[model samples]
Target: MKEQLIEKFENDMKKRSYFLRLLLVIDQFFNVLFWNGSQDETISSHVGRRIKSGKANRFEKLLCKFLSKLESEHCKKSLGE
Candidate 1:
């Protein structure tokens, strides 16, 4: 399930406009610094850590938004909401 969510997030991000994609790359750079980590880290780990720490930056927030939206939609479909 986690892998599926991550895959969906990646696909959604790819569908974003070029400008937004550029901004996301910049955000990712800063987030890497804020995380005091390397750029090699996967976004999923970064977002998971930010969610735990309650210090999500723009990129992390965007990821959280995407995940929440997906989960809620999944729930609604399952429950016929």
Candidate 2:
């Protein structure tokens, strides 16, 4: 029973480690492809349209704010400068 428990724990740990590595690779890929400060054209258009509509829903304003914030943070992190 003790051996079985140890084996199970080891297997679980290996699985967790594999998951972490996979996640890291995914993150790195995204960071390279869409690093911080990158503005998505669709977001720009939507935000512009909402602002110009003179009738933005609360959610639109919130989304703009969120995107602006994300852009700023990403801009600082991106090596583009």
Candidate 3:
């Protein structure tokens, strides 16, 4: 299962441009930190500091959309829906 997920993620990355791939990597880093119990606002502040405020919001929206798609796919596979 883990291997399949990694393969899928890698293939998805390959389809994206280098700039987008970098943003996704940064977003995933913060996501992992958030999962490890970091406060949401704290992570948001860090991202905002690292990226322009306007661009940060755009990246966040993109991240949310990507995450929603991945979650939907996972749920369908898990529940056989």
Candidate 4:
């Protein structure tokens, strides 16, 4: 069963080009970090300090929430939805 599953995955992957796979991997990471609430973490520690001390935009906060939700949904799907 495990070998069959692996073979199926390999077969599916063979249909995709290397560039496409790279793009997908990049996009998935971007979605999780950019859309997810991790932007604050991405900003250098110093910049993050400034953003925290100073006021952050309302839209930025909204974006954090949006990204968090998307991340959650993606996780749910990956868990075998």
lDDT of each: 0.61, 0.53, 0.51, 0.49
Compared with the true structure, model 3 gives a TM-score of: 0.31
lDDT of 3 by residue, 1-81 (tens): 999999987997789989976775675566567644233223333443434434455665554446458675331232210
What digit string (tens of lDDT, one per residue) describes model 4 on residues 12-56? Answer: 699888897676566555645755534223322222333456654
Per-model TM-score on C-alpha atoms? 0.35, 0.33, 0.31, 0.39
RMSD of each: 10.4, 15.0, 11.9, 10.2
Task: List where candidate 2 sits over 4 angstroms from the true fold.
Answer: 1-41, 72-81
Stronger candidate by lDDT (3 vs 4): 3
Candidate number achieving the greatest TM-score relative to the actual structure: 4
lDDT of 1: 0.61
Error of 3 at 55 (Å): 28
lDDT of 1 by residue, 1-81 (tens): 999999988897778987977765675676577766556443555666656677767776676667667675331232210
Q: How close is candidate 1 to the true structure, as a TM-score?
A: 0.35
Top lDDT hit: 1
